[model samples]
Target: MKKRLLILPLLVITVLLAGCIGDGTKNMEQQTELKGVLKLDGSTTVYPIAKTAAEEFMKLHPAVTIDVQQSSTGEGLVKFLAGETDISDATRAPKDNEYAEAQRKGMKLHMTVISNDAVGIIVHTSNPVSDLTTAQLKAIYFDGTITDWSQLTNGTKKGKINIYNTDPKISGTAELFNTKIAGSADKPYVAGTTIIHPTPKMIPTIKDDPDGLAYTPVNWINNEVKMVKVNGVAPTQKTILDTSYLLSRKMYMITDGAPKGLNREFISYILSGDGQSIVQKEGFIPVT
Candidate 1:
């Protein structure tokens, strides 16, 4: 009877110990399994890098979900200030008013520079003009002084310039072009410039029209259009990195504040060597 009693106690202890061990193992698994949703929005110009990074990140952490949206930089800032997104991709830093609004909402904005790219002056592939001086660019885009292709010093063609402007209200590309190349926002595009949205849209329209001229992120440059040299400097990776390219700008990922938890992890991944490699692969100059 004493043996039976001792055996019963041992068996109870064994079962209880087994249950505890199993629970510990399960808890460990739960802790290691990254399971959550991460939201990212903004900057169609930065969308390629963001999308590539998000895809690679989700592969390593299949349980985690990442949602990336290609709203313009302005819209992304709006969403970030409104608390609609976890991160905002931007082609430029937030404006003063944007920072003021975030302060009013008691949110601290943190900006991370991820990559560098230039606003390329693109013309149809057949256009003979290969390089433009800054003065000529300002004249063409800002002062409406050069409206015909023949007006260029090297020009051999005689068509009226078909200018395409990115939507200044939303596109950072347009805003940067206006600020850097055109000299100021007040100078404005010559009256009749066609306004395009999403940057890439300018590609097809310009490709179809031989006389078209537009500015877009260098990554979007393809054989369909010829990227003109600005002030005798091409928007190559070397020039962009060296700051010799006149229109170079830093791309960013903005958070409400210093990121925490999964947000921190994801941003770390983006700044990692692998992430920077992806940025280069996508034709943008990696910040690292």
Candidate 2:
């Protein structure tokens, strides 16, 4: 991913201008021709955007092929470093150890920011708790200082808390939650916790478990679960963009080095019109 890549003028086809008034077949006639199979994996959170991009991109360049997989960020980076992937979608930057390993292997990694996202603190809809301070979030998720809902609700909702989180070992979202909110990842997690994988499942798990306290990507929030405020700020698009929400963070697409050839073109395409549109529709804040 290169700096200024997003703003780089795309090879805008006049057919796209014609699309405002043309039929589908007319737009197809003007598709840019590129040939290659792009392999993208990692960050199930980013899969929605990447998958949609791949589908739409292939439609334009019929000869180009793409395969996208929804694995955790760490898992994707593992394959990326091992030469198994063309790009790794991530919710957080590579860890220091990963950069060191890349240096040892003489691999130069490049990062391109794609969109904005936030870790959403959530609980079952039936729960009365609505807000959690950063201190309280850390206390509940990492320090074991707060375990029961009664501690936050003043005995009005008295129950032992059931905590849920994606495994920090494999999830960038979880790592972001622990490192950003909890302030560290080395500490031991408290007991009575259910560790999930892939982040999105935290939704249904918390939705069904009335006493659960959990965090997940904001995109996953639905009517089944209730999102909790961090400090006094709700995780809304405006709040994420202004970064008034403490948990907001950027989404990234990583490459082995400064991208070139089909890779560069594909990444550049994402930063442009159609790609950014997909990002916003997929529940991410467009970087553009």
Instruction: Write down the lDDT of every candidate, Cα atoms only.
Output: 0.88, 0.87
**Model 1 lDDT on a 0 to 1 scale:** 0.88
- The segments of candidate 1 whose C-alpha lies over 4 angstroms from its true place after superposition are 1-26, 153-155
Total backbone clashes of candidate 1, pairs 3 or more residues apart or in separate chains: 0
The local lDDT score (0 to 100) that residue 10 gets in candidate 1 is 100
Residue 246 lDDT in model 1? 89
Give the worst 10-residue stretch by lDDT in candidate 2.
Answer: 6-15
Each candidate's number of clashing pairs is 0, 0
Task: Give me candidate 1's TM-score against the actual structure.
Answer: 0.90
lDDT of 2 by residue, 70-129 (tens): 899989988988888899999888988889888888899899998999999999898988
Give lDDT: candidate 2, residue 34. Answer: 84
